[model samples]
Target: MDLNVTLVLIGVDIPRSGLLRSGYPDPRTGQWVFSPAKTAKSFNPSAVTQTERRFDLVDLAPFDYDSAEGMTAFVQHLAGIEGRLRLLRARPGMLTEGEMPEYLFRRTHGIVGLLKRLIEDGCTEAMESGAEELTPELLSTIQINLGNLDDRDPTAGEIPEVPHNVPVPARKARKKDRNSVFDDRGGSVAGG
Candidate 1:
């Protein structure tokens, strides 16, 4: 007979390293879904259930933006935030967590720009902290999507090598003198 002991929570809030997971809206539907990284790692032990219902965080795969759009749209969104978090927190039925991604996503997708802003902010913090080495800790954690080709799957080889079509503006091969039809200079030319 399997005796089911009531699960007890003894401790909480144990911080550990983990991937800053990402999620995005479906192209067909606007619903938010986990990115490949998150979806892939969801099966891992760190994500499934902690020992005695506790988690030891881990980063299996790094989080990032969509396949086609890249991080540009994400950065644009972050940069667009005008420091009015109240509006963002108030949306999606006043649930900040559920709505934050959408709130961010609605504006833009420039991840690299957002990261640059974060680094700039961290630099400000570094300035205020008397140039302490520990100050960079905050800056170190930031994961910026710089749209690097390293993000691609190595097994896939090159990305099909898109042939760029450069349009060359055609210049007039010959310059012709202007002739006015009403000048009547060619009126007798038909006699030939």
Candidate 2:
């Protein structure tokens, strides 16, 4: 019996100190070179030897937290405001309207995960308090867990100014561009 197997590993902010144990400055090129016993004692050398290929994927573009339209769209999507069923029953002039988006940006420091939690908690609080809409006073009562990633101190910067009367552009809607080679005789898609 014969078998072909491939394994791929993906990680973020992986620490390289353990892999490159010790290095001395090269006398010829004045560059640091790993010593013969570079691998840490805990790391199995066989694993490194077995790794046929290593690829570092390019980082994706960061979210435009500064864009009022983008942030509003994100909040609306999370709250199901644009959908048939609403996750948060925000008052008419709140959330996607007025200064709520700016206020939320300040509170969450523009972090999407944190913003989601904040809105979810605010919704729960509103429901419990019998409030019709989310208010600054009501949301202030809800505590957000920042964890280790963000500082408890308020983010230092002026909130991005939102343009008035400017319509938020709709997301581009287009059919996926497919290769003509995949089309069958009946003009239907065939398995690649």
Candidate 3:
């Protein structure tokens, strides 16, 4: 629920060319003027597909940047993965109404796991790196600080299983055949 540190972030630029908009004809000039479009809201009801995507080392807290090449490579690699994930998630109607809750669960679960691993990795890396470069007093401080972090639980704890009272169909209704139209299975859809 509360995170003090931001491990990794991705920025995406949705090009204007990709946006879907509506237009209204002006009564006086007979010219079409742009208006807000419910493109995403109207389009999501008939889609069916769910996927789980994995991004390795999402926030590598314990990553050692001993050398410039290692740091640069790590940054570039993480950036690429983050960028791809952001784009995948940013698309409209990617998560159907039924899938929204599950998507949120997966995303939050993934982030918590990432944070846990990062802390563990950071502790190990810090100890090793500290042994090599840190002074006795500095090492003591590092040990005290990171040692306290070891006991903390990184999981999103105590999630009670709530039954879905609504009767959910085994399969979501699709507007078109899966083969006819592309599904959101780790790839971009045609109009989406």
Candidate 4:
């Protein structure tokens, strides 16, 4: 906690502009903020679609860079991906701007999985970029935001307690050599 390792991070927003993009709307807030918003353009296979869209904010918080595979994927992306590679691309404004770009690519197309992967990628890149303080806090926030969609664990809300009186085993203390002093060495020639 005391070490001063400065880490740089970038926040990313996936482009939600294609017809195929799908996600749940913000349930409590009743907004399309976090969800993917696909443009409902008249069924046009003819028109070109911008693969990536911008997001709200990006944070480059201090963090510990962990995970090799994650860093690899991020490096690959930075090196350049096949299709539209949408991401925050790292800047101080990312944290303040509150928006990111999303890209539509043919491969790696599982919506939910891909999004999670992208976030993971962002964190990896951030760490590689020398961000020490921002990564953890930023990543934690991203998780908290996205965790909204996940169903809460049923056990988490419940209170825990000790069950019925299953008896605990007892340990015995060793008795001291109390009778040792009373025994005369049996050599009574001089003292007798």
Best by TM-score: 2
Q: Candidate 1, which ten residues in sequence have the lowest lDDT sum?
A: 10-19
Ranking by TM-score: 2, 1, 4, 3
lDDT of each: 0.36, 0.52, 0.34, 0.36
Rank list by lDDT:
2, 1, 4, 3
Indicate which candidate wins on lDDT: 2
CA lDDT of 149 in candidate 2?
Answer: 47
RMSD of 4: 22.3
Model 2 misplaced regions, further than 4 Å: 1-62, 67-94, 146-192
RMSD of each: 19.9, 18.3, 27.6, 22.3
Question: Which parts of model 4 have CA positions greater than 4 angstroms off?
Answer: 1-154, 157-161, 171-176
Better of 2 and 4 by TM-score: 2
Predicted candidate 2 versus true structure: per-residue lDDT over 1-192, tens digit per residue: 324555454332222324333445566765545434436565685454332213322222223566777765656654454243243564444665555666666676555556667777877777887884576667677777545644323332112222223223333578998889865567656684
Q: What lDDT tens digits, residue by residue, belong to model 1 across residues 15-107?
A: 221223344446576543443332344557355323313222322221146653544444344445423323212233221233333333322
Error of model 2, residue 192, in angstroms: 84
**Model 3 C-alpha lDDT per residue in residues 18-99, reported as the tens digit of each score:** 2313334466765445444334554563221111011111222233345666545544543443344322123333222344
Stretches of model 1 off by over 4 angstroms after superposition: 1-27, 31-63, 81-124, 130-138, 141-192
TM-score for candidate 4, residues paired by index: 0.18
Clashing pairs for predicted structure model 3, backbone only: none
